[model samples]
Target: MSPEDRPAGSGPQAALPGCYRHPGTETGVSCTRCERPICPQCMVTASVGFQCPECVGRGHTGARRATTRFGGVPVADGALVTRLLILANLLVWVLAAYVFTPQLDRVWSLYSVGLHRNGPEGVAEGPDQWYRLLTATFLHVEWWHIGTNMLALLVLGPALEEALGRLRFLGLYLLAGLGGSTLGFLIDGDWLNSRGASGAIFGLIGATVVLQLRTKGPLGPVLALLVFNAIVTYSRRDAIDWRAHLGGLLLGALVAVGLMYAPRERRGLVQGLTVVAALAVEAGMLAIGMGLYGG
Candidate 1:
């Protein structure tokens, strides 16, 4: 509703239901600049009610926000997001073979380290192994595992990368995979083996879910695809790691929160801080666990 239409003296108490953030405070406050609705508590509360916190950044000059052809889509360097991510995964696969190996099992190494925690027959022996989180993501056992994952990565990844950009999209993929691996480790911590790119891929699905929700777009196709894939993964017995998939999904969501929907001003900073904090926490936990748990 336009400001002129509403009664002035109501103190914005009845204004557009405020932000779901502050329940008590009522204020219409059109943010003076950004024009987004903000509650009284969130408002700067200036002469004409208050300005949006975003507006405060420049100290008040009539600057129009840049509008893009696609609202959420990211445009950066010429490199496409999907290609970059696929390349990164491939590089990791190579690294798992030669570079990261202080010792090489050849057969047991892939799917046992960064992206997925399983290799050979069952999940690897070491839970606190530092390289597993990143390395496990790259290794997959079955022919179909890599095939489907790479396909999905190619298809879903491009749109998301276009929306979120190369770096953020890559971050989401890695973080989700790590989360999945971490959960698998935390739950079984012993017998159950873990492996596959499904966990990290699941993260992409999670991010897409949120992106669809935020943009108010149709998720019917995405939902159907995810459901079908999930069923297949479960029926295949030892072919997939459901637990790691779930963990990676949740972690991907947390990472996606900032990348997909953070406020204009807060987006990059919030995501950066979160990634830094999560990596630090993960490192610390692994260090402590290794010291205490033997392997």
Candidate 2:
């Protein structure tokens, strides 16, 4: 190839000046970096000459993606933890409805009565009944109960999980449920059986609202929704455990505050400890409720 025929950025490999991708197609332009002959289609305009798309992509391969202020990796899809929680609740609800008459609810539901209930013989009871704290969040009697809770979860879980991440969100949910159960069992003395995911759902709401507040995002919508739900809960006092909802909401908000205020270098540790502390508080509450720790 003549020297005059060589492009400004041409290298020895592009001496003949045929497109590397298309041997028959002549390309006067060469990649500004790699200096490979590139056809018009392969050329990516640059400040100097032109670069190949491959070279441009290679240049960016080492670059890290942008993350959220809370250090969460940005996601394009919905929350996996939320979906899994919904699925588990649905499966448990189905089994409770079909496979196990009323037995599942009786065993899993949180009752105001003691762990050792004065009920029919052969019924499962004792310390193991303590599992009701978490299990009750999964068990729902009425379809509307599950439907409302699931819908609220569908709305709230993704946003909260996006802010807190999967593991922390999971911890928030469980601790919220435990907190709700502990408070309900201690306070709601007249109510016999209480079971629903509303407490956990309320926790998700609280987390979302607090996250929005921490990020300085709009909080009107979330606060309004919370107020409306609280009103609805109070209106249905005959049926709903609003006390549990309140407890879970407060606990979730406190956890979110701790998470948001934690040092950036030790955020994960602080988050984990925050959840553990919440659990410890719930445990203490339960022991007190059960008269085990000098209550």
Candidate 3:
């Protein structure tokens, strides 16, 4: 109503209406630049998130907060992502194996939502076109790979989704896969042929690891599990792309932290922004890696 009470910063601008992140807090802080009344607790003045104390301590005199209410806690709707991921991969594999029979001299092509390995073009030449980013994650070279990954997904996905809510869970799956693709592209090195959901699967691993840390799970087992997987991926040297796995793991870890720690409403927003950011970072890294390793 009054000038001072006109709500500070873009307070809660990014979050849902009447659904402030922190129900306990009230005085919404506006972004200094935008005059957006953000919840002092859920404020993101710059790129990073901060609380009222930290925000004020940093000497940010830009804007302030307005009155607000916390939103509902997000909920999981089964492992929607896990099933979608599985279906996509299986469909691609079926098409590739059955519908589009491979030939010795020439290659037959089928489209999948996730990335796919082209003959020799590597990723640059590969069919990673827009659809592949989503599809490539579905298909795996071997049934065993899919089975193992799927099992892991079953073990982790539902729980993760429950913790992150269905929406954020979906975001996690997608962003992790994107990160994995980035890793694959950077490491493929003119090889031009790779596929699988390990990137996202690995992302699940990373997320789980973070969850463990957040809940203070025994550090030794979590660290060991990661180490074992990294060792396997790197040493396998067969068809697996450890780089993608690494990227997924790294991205997953970051995403997990963001989801676990960031405000609930911001989960979707953060995940969306993180995915976009991951893509840009992945593309940049891909370019650099191509230059250095393209050989």
Using TM-score as the measure, the top candidate is 2
Q: Candidate 2 — which residues are off by over 4 angstroms? A: 1-68, 71-78, 115-126, 189-191, 292-295
Per-residue CA lDDT of model 3 for 167-243, tens digit only, reads 66777887788788766666654444556788888898899888877777766765776788788888896857776
Residues 1-295 of candidate 1: C-alpha lDDT, one tens digit per residue: 7778877766636445555346565555567767777786677876775776766867756774443222243466423767766776666555555665634323333222222333322233454444655666777545466778888887678767767766677777887877777666555444444556778888888888888887888999788877987787689757567777777777777777666666666665776777886566555644443333333
- For model 1, the stretches where C-alpha displacement exceeds 4 angstroms are 1-79, 88-128, 280-295
Worst 10 residues of 1 by lDDT: 113-122
What do the candidate models score in CA lDDT, each in turn?
0.64, 0.79, 0.63
TM-scores for all candidates: the values are: 0.61, 0.71, 0.61
- Best-to-worst ranking by TM-score: 2, 3, 1
lDDT of 2 by residue, 130-154 (tens): 7887898899878999999999999
Clash counts for the predictions, in order: 16, 0, 32
> How many clashes show up in model 1?
16
